[model samples]
Target: MEISGYIALAVMGITLGLVGAGGSILTIPILVYLLQVPITLATSYSLVVVGSTAFIGLLRYRDHILFRKAILFLIPSALGVFAARRFIVPTLSNILGHLLLGQVLVILLIIFMGIAGYFMIKRPILDIQNHSHKKQNIKKSKVVLIGLALGIIMGLLGAGGGFLIIPTLVLLMHFAMREAVATSLFIIAINSFIGFVTNQSQFIASDWGNLKKYLTPSLLGMLIGLYIVKFINGEILKKSFGYFIWVVGIAILTKEFIL
Candidate 1:
């Protein structure tokens, strides 16, 4: 590939390392704007790449991840992903296909990223100090609800769902931020895989050359990111990452709106 392509791949890796979900948000833009892949194809490709990377990361952190809780969350999310992929995304994409659909997808991507960015910056005050007893009482229900909600978003938008999952775990479920991040990666991996499987037919029809080009570099970057997670102060970095997301989202939105 060219220098620019390598640069973009490196950027993607660094972004994922610094902030878990940014890779999904940036994947479509890189494929479409930089590599000239069609938007629909780009979205599918992004899901495959992000899902694969998240799966690898989750595997590395499996020992630390809370499996019982993760499974509880995954069940509802799996159901949600099935429902959305079977009923929602195809319907919406069909309706919007003619009206600059690529632009519309880009706009939606930006909106989601912007919301994620804002949440990152705000860093909701989590009260985990004395909620141990309360957590046991309501944790299952909260995990299921969050999983369903996150799954719907993932199915609809091709997102990895880390943005929603991490916050939900940390703020409402009262998990430590680090554990939440680890858990979110697992959830994102599962949901993204399910969502991609739901759209397998369409993907098979598309030209997937760019995705091939992306695999090695993206995986290398993800490995680097996983390694970095061990040493970083995630909370502070997450806040700064939010600012970065805001800038990228606005820039993408502006480009779509104006040109």
Candidate 2:
């Protein structure tokens, strides 16, 4: 079962490589449940592993870079990430009320997975023919607000908030799914790095026992997944991944809350 769990992480890597968001969503579960890593340390480890993997994804999708738009999101997100990891995560206690913090985090993850699942499954509602004007209507002010919110979620949950950003990219920025996903990789990398640096001191001190056992396979899997994505048509894969997300979400809820 332990070995199977480790093997299953290849899917996590590929998902992150493809989406720039789901890797950490799956990482925490594998580390904490399968490998028996503690929840708090698993959160920190997820940042390192997912950030590293997604950085490589960003490079693969570099041509998709849209600095003019990417920067509009990255700056405010960076600040939010730094503050959350530096201040909030450190101060958090082991328990909130009667429940373990880990329990709370898992529940939150399940909620997000459900929402993200919907995002993946839905067809694009906005049209691209007049997208230039739609893009213009997306105010920088609103982007900054959303970016900050996303950053805080990443810092607190150790999951990339791509589901939130990708829609903005497609509907408001008028990017296709692939471009939005690639741009999201850039955002995740920027946000993850800020959070990682804020916790650098403790990160250096923590006993990240056999973390490489997880990272090596994840990176390898991401590379494979990236290649596979090129051959797939867009909407087909989108709805497919959406259903996959629902399965994962339901599985997590059953394991954490019910089982």
Candidate 3:
């Protein structure tokens, strides 16, 4: 089981390397179930793993990162993620019964998985000629709002909000797909890092070595995945992965609410 867990963590990194966003979706589940971590700690642990891998990925695209946009997007998300991890999660855990909140969060994660899967399957229509218009049409307010929301979700779940962030950058900020992806990776890395570092548990000195144990192999997998992407078709892998996410989401729902 432990070896299998390591393999799963690597697979999570490969997915991230292949697709960029879905790995966070798998992080918490991997930590909670495969690594046998508690839900509360698992979420925090996930941030470390996801953030580290993302930062590594970001290093490759360092030249492509939009500093202006990344910083603007980070302001709200950073604060929100910190606040959620510091104050909100513990409160929620206290207020809701263990079965209730875990069940509810699992349900929400499933819904997000389905939405992510759908978008992965349905590639958006792109107009190469309208690139300039797409770049100029973004609403700063929408960007800020979404940034705040994404931060909170990331903090609470310890999952990168890449699925949502990528679309927001493309649709709202008028960024090209490549730019949007690079920028989103930057945003996610900063957001997760801030949330992980400022966590309340740090004051109490929680066991972060556990996170490193899971993170090390995932990073190795990410590097291998990066190499594999040289030959693989990302679009095809993305869609197939989406279907896999859909199935996993349904399976989680079924396990929680059904049999």
lDDT of 3 by residue, 1-259 (tens): 7778889999988888877777678877777666777667777788888888888887777788788867767898888898898888778879996767777677677877888788777765245325535546566877888889889888988888888888777677667777777787888888888888777345343465566688888998888877787788888888888898888888777877899
| Number of backbone-clashing residue pairs for each candidate, in the order shown | 0, 0, 1
Model 3 poorest ten-residue lDDT run: 124-133
Candidate number with greatest lDDT = 3
lDDT of 3: 0.78
Residue 242 in model 2: lDDT: 77
RMSD per model, one decimal: 3.2, 2.9, 2.4
Candidate order (TM-score): 3, 2, 1
Q: Quote the positional error of residue 119 for candidate 2 in Å.
A: 0.9
lDDT tens digits by residue: candidate 1, 99-194: 566666677788788887777777443543344333454656877887887777676666776777776776667667668777888888877788
**Comparing 1 and 3 on TM-score, the stronger one:** 3
- Model 2 CA lDDT for position 161: 73
Error at 53, model 1, angstroms: 1.0
Q: Tell me how far the alpha carbon of residue 104 in candidate 2 is from the true structure, in angstroms, after superposition.
A: 1.9
How well does candidate 2 score on lDDT at residue 247? Answer: 88
Residue 12 of model 2: what lDDT?
A: 83
Q: Give the lDDT of residue 26 in candidate 2.
A: 71
- True-vs-predicted CA distance for residue 255, candidate 3, Å: 1.3
